[model samples]
Target: MAESNCTQVTEFTLTGFTDNPVTQVTLFLMFLLIYLVTVLGNLGMILLIKVSPQLHSPMYYFLGNLAFVDLCSSTVITPKMLVDFISKKGIAYAGCMAQVFIYDLFGMTEGFLLATMAYDRYMAVCHPLLYPLVMSPKCCFQLVTGSYLIGLTNGIGQTIGMSTLSFCSSSVIDLFFCDISPLISLSTSDTTLSHVILRTSACLFGVSSSLVILVSYVAIISAILSISSAEGKRKAFSTCTSHLITLSLFYGTVFFVYLKPSSDSSREDKWAAVLYTVVTPMLNPLIYSLRNKEVKEALRRLTKIK
Candidate 1:
């Protein structure tokens, strides 16, 4: 905890999942493909939402924000990882810190954005008559802005907390990318405060967002079941199924990655990292677009498909 104990390291080597050249190249190609999909998918989602008049709604607005967050988050980590696989030069200290900040920013953004979307669905399914008034344009903008602001505040707190810890001697970080847990585990200086902040933020961002999503859905499900007709119930549930699946995949992977202690890094943690960082980004747009009939119809109109 003392300032004198802080030794400043200039850079950190990334101990990626494997060391074999063949494996490295393979992983490089794999992640390269994934990054490409993430870019195109999220980009297409935003563009389609923008141009399609039929797609303009509170739900789509939140989806656009989610797409942007997924795009940014994947861009922050995957590209650097692919380059590191080939170059093996590792990231500079400032670069690693920036990666940590940007990645977490978008990660937290996606969590809140998903919660926002859940609330959007709740209003649509449970309060259809008042949905338009309650979730007005101004209200929607505020929700999106609030999600980004929350994400920004959390990123700043984590970065400042990390800056206080002095990394010395060992420059090798144990994850594929610069992450909070691995960085803290590799820190040579005192990290009691850093650890406490990390745990608190994880719970704050992860658990709180999850709780909001769960509560929204509880009300949503209750409203759906009260409908008289089977067709009505099916139609009501259909609107939220995509979001529920997205929430499950994103929050499940996040909890697995961050809820536990940092001292407990394993091969499983690395793979779990892959799920959130790589797989989730790529899957989100797919989940929303492929499952939603409205999105499908919008895409058809966008592409001039019959």
Candidate 2:
């Protein structure tokens, strides 16, 4: 009986932002512009890092990978979301599950990458003499590969937990994109195990990574304070200011959405989702390039060569 009921929901109707034609058109145009900028900006960052000899360092290497992740994360959701604004927003169960898995994959990877970046920054600031040895090419590659591996594991676990449940209730998800909370609300079977999986993964990836960032920054700050000159202090802080901003933006909205109970999720949660999912990717390149002198110089050099 449960199997038959679960099989009944082949498709889900997404209750997107608005039903008004004018509003939809307006939002569609806005999101389209954002998506275009996101694609161009992240791609430009990656290309600049690739071609610029000045950017051939451990820092920029990680940065290039970050741009790739941001580009992919935005592409996964923004195109479908833009289409939903114009047409009837319906998604097959398989498609929805795919979205959930990919979304979780990128989301978790981004968090781990941020923590890795924090550790990189800490090494650079706190141990300048040993930075090259400690953060060698092999080490950096391993860190990034580990981040993706962890993300892949979490994605598989979450998707399996979600798939085992029976969505026999209503087929309407009250968000712009598919997420664990909304899907859990629609399940007819007991979701205790699923919730446990969700919370456990959240702690394992989210909270643990956050702790890594916190500890790294604390040591970073201590080392910066030990600098004898004001100019030296300023330079040290400047190196990480952009990363600090990006981390705050990404984690702020993520924690707001995921840390709370599903029953507590509301329309406000959707808007918060928009921040990390859509807006953060768009802003990452801007924040990094605008704030970092090295990136700006690389852009100028590349433009002259072109």
Candidate 3:
């Protein structure tokens, strides 16, 4: 295509989940409920961690940050998604890029935070005596800060890469939001740079963070097995169950959606995107609180005070 003939796309129309009016209404109600739970659950978790003296520790500290990331991630996508279900709104080019940047920012940060939580678990389970020294307040702060910094870098790289592409082909996004794959597909210009950036960011954040979690859990499991008493083993392993579940839900959907060979967005990809983006945030707080005795106790204390 000649540069002179290329028409710059000013806005992109988002093709949301369904076209049927009944289905759209049904999905809207369901997603609205999910978003409500997500917001309240994540916000409550953060507040609980902040106000409860009992929850003051490296683990809960990391949990609080995770809740904040989940909140931000869900907020960035769900509100727009809810609006789209009822209305046909066109996202401006700048708005689309902003959405991509913000979504990737929190998404990448969540990956690193999950890994950091795994490391915290390993320290607690494997090196109980040294955990306090190793994962001190300063160290914890640095780790959290590092996660955000890396996430910021990824967001900038991805947005810049997407910005470089000229969307002269079409203005309609197949999926509900402005994602990397969908945007690349819409670009008339060469998408090699965008693909490179996408793959590099995925490998850097996805593989590296997953490796950290894997290594940490390996040592943790080994330490748990070393405990002679059955009760001791159960008690030690119980601490990790919630985190393991949360990790499985998060990474499972993420890997399914992004790590696949074909870049073509499918129905499965759209639903899987919902799992990581909408459902996971709402589930995290419940998983942690219901399984954790300390968190339950903290909640009870909070309720009594109220």
Q: What does candidate 2's lDDT look like per residue over 225-299, in tens digits?
A: 999999999999999999999999998888798778767877898889999999999999999999998999999
Instruction: Write candidate 3's Cα lDDT for 49-68 as tens digits.
Output: 99999999999999999999
Worst 10 residues of 3 by lDDT: 257-266
Clashes of 3: 0
Q: Roughly what TM-score does model 3 have, to 2 decimal places?
A: 0.97
TM-score of each: 0.95, 0.96, 0.97
lDDT of 1 by residue, 143-193 (tens): 999999989988888888788778775788878888887788778778998
RMSD of each: 1.8, 1.6, 1.4
> What overall lDDT goes with each candidate model?
0.88, 0.91, 0.92
Query: Model 3, 94: alpha-carbon shift in Å?
Result: 1.0
Q: Of models 1 and 3, which has the larger lDDT?
A: 3
Best by lDDT: 3
Q: 227 in model 3: Cα distance from truth in Å?
A: 1.4
